[model samples]
Target: MNLQKFSLEQLASFVQGKAVGQTEMQLDGLASLTQADAHKLAFVNADKYLDQANQSKAGALIVTEELRAHITSQQNFIVVENPYLAFAILTHVFEKKHTAQGIEATAQIHASAIISDTAYIGHYAVIGEHCVVGDETVIQSHCHIDDGVEIGKQCFIDSHVVLTGHCKLGNRVRIHANTVIGGEGFGFAPYKGKWHRIAQLGSVLIGNDVRIGSNCSIDRGALDDTIIEDGVILDNLVQIAHNVKVGANTAMAAKCGVAGSTTIGKNCIFAGAVGVVGHINIADNVTVTGMSMVTKSISEAGSYSSGTPMLESLHWKRAAVRFKQLADAPLTQMLKRLDHMQAQIESLESTFKLRK
Candidate 1:
């Protein structure tokens, strides 16, 4: 029997789903409905994509209850509560597992540091004094784990990543290459016509299953710890400023910046290059679109966007001119124009009354 090929019955049992058609048909891999082959499985999540799913050439389809009516008799399918989530589970099952074991001889480890026997410390990696590295954790090459840091089990710290100043990370945390945690925040005070730097006295607290991408900077707080709650995913070049409390399961895309002291609630999604101002509270389940500038606190859960949409140069120039004129237009002149129009209407009404 082929290791990759599984019967539709076995697939449904694996995903804990209900089979709609012939369960004896075999499947090899997963693919998009538009590109799926006879051996692959395709999934439909939205109502708009139901027609495409029904017309797909895949041997098997995974769909929600809303899409069951659209499927034709020729299709072999599985009905699940959430097709997209079920597909996500399948991706994990198909993922290649890499297990790294044993510390490299080239690593610079302090005698006072505590490292698990099962952990893998890569070449040129630095483990500072009093630091704790948990079991099965892989610290990749050139990583710097500073003094008093605590990293839990099964965590993956990628190459050149820096965890400074007693930072803490829970189990299964993943930090990609060149990401810096516990760097000093941008805090300054005016003193004698010069700026005085405020000491960054706190570290970063990253909860379980948090994955931070490459080149991202999470600054150390001025006083309290900069906390990233469980399941927070930060994309590449993302800037999470000091004293920020990112609630659980919030995902931020590439180049998104959250200013200092902001409290972002759970399940919030920030698209690429979105900016959130300091001292603001963003409610749960809020989604900010790409390149949006959030200048204030959001009190409700909804999609929020800012910045003007892209327009043609000529049309934008004309609109810009009109926008500038609106500010220059006098209130008295607007009231006068309204009064004159009302007078004209009244005169027209009198003329109609005379004609009648």
Candidate 2:
């Protein structure tokens, strides 16, 4: 736990919220409404959690203006436009900065590399030739920064990270542990029924404020650069293939994969397990639901979902049979057949009337 203490007024000011109650009290930390102690601050973003907020033992609570009046609590409250956002802003105040000091003796830095005076290089970290590490950049232990890599100011390269082959990271980028950036793109050419390797010539360019989660793989380009624009956040185990251009502020959930040469527009949200094929383009502000597969270009911006909803065992078995029948003859073909059957029945009725 952080030993630092923040006054109620100070916390409210930091989040640009209004302190509606007592301001003399101090808070040591933050927690959820249900788990907060008397010295901790908490937040309630919705009406469903109001019960927890009323019962909370927190020193102070951040609440929205709409929910503030509904709460029947005597606890101190900080009213903000968005309580969740305010909570996010205050989280940084209590976060512990990395304690690793100056460049360690065990670090192996190339003579051609340029490291900032304010940078921290941890034990066994490797800095390759011609690499540039900017001010306040922290390359943690076992990190391998390969040749020609450039990392901008205040970038955090976590433990076991591999940044290689002309990769460039902009300022304030945070790559978590075990993430591999600028790896070789999977480019292959087939000739005479065998596979041949294609030399990857381009690099990866990551913009400022990008956060890549752990175990993520971002491949270098085969010819054109793979670009991840500013403010993009990638969840763990995401795969970004070569020559792909991800626009600014795009957020992808865990296990999302964008295949090579795809261009995704700005502010797109891809939920968990979303898979996008190569050579496609997605428009801005697109929201892909979880477990969705994007096989073609998304020309319009909107929400998309695929696959069947969860069902019980017996119901799923019956639906599965119908799904197979529909696959054999889709909706259009089935409708055409229905029209033909109706026409035949009307002709038979007319013939019977003529015979009478």
lDDT per residue for candidate 2 within 1-356, as digits (tens), equals: 43999889999999888887779788888998888988999998999988888888887889988888877874588999999999999889998887655799999999999999999999999999999999999999999999999999999999999998699999999999999999999999999999999999999999999999999999999999999999999999999999999999999999999999999999999999999999999999999999999999999999999878899999999999987887675776988999999999999999999999
Task: Please provide TM-scores, in order, for all candidate models, with all chains considered together.
Answer: 0.84, 0.93
lDDT of 1 by residue, 140-247 (tens): 999999999999999999999999968999999999999999988999999899999899998899999999999999998989989999999999999999999999
Q: Model 1: how far is 117 from its true place, Å?
A: 3.1
Q: Residue 320 of model 2: what lDDT?
A: 98
Model 2 residue 309 lDDT score = 81
Q: Local distance difference test, per candidate?
A: 0.91, 0.93
- Our tally of clashes for model 2 stands at 0
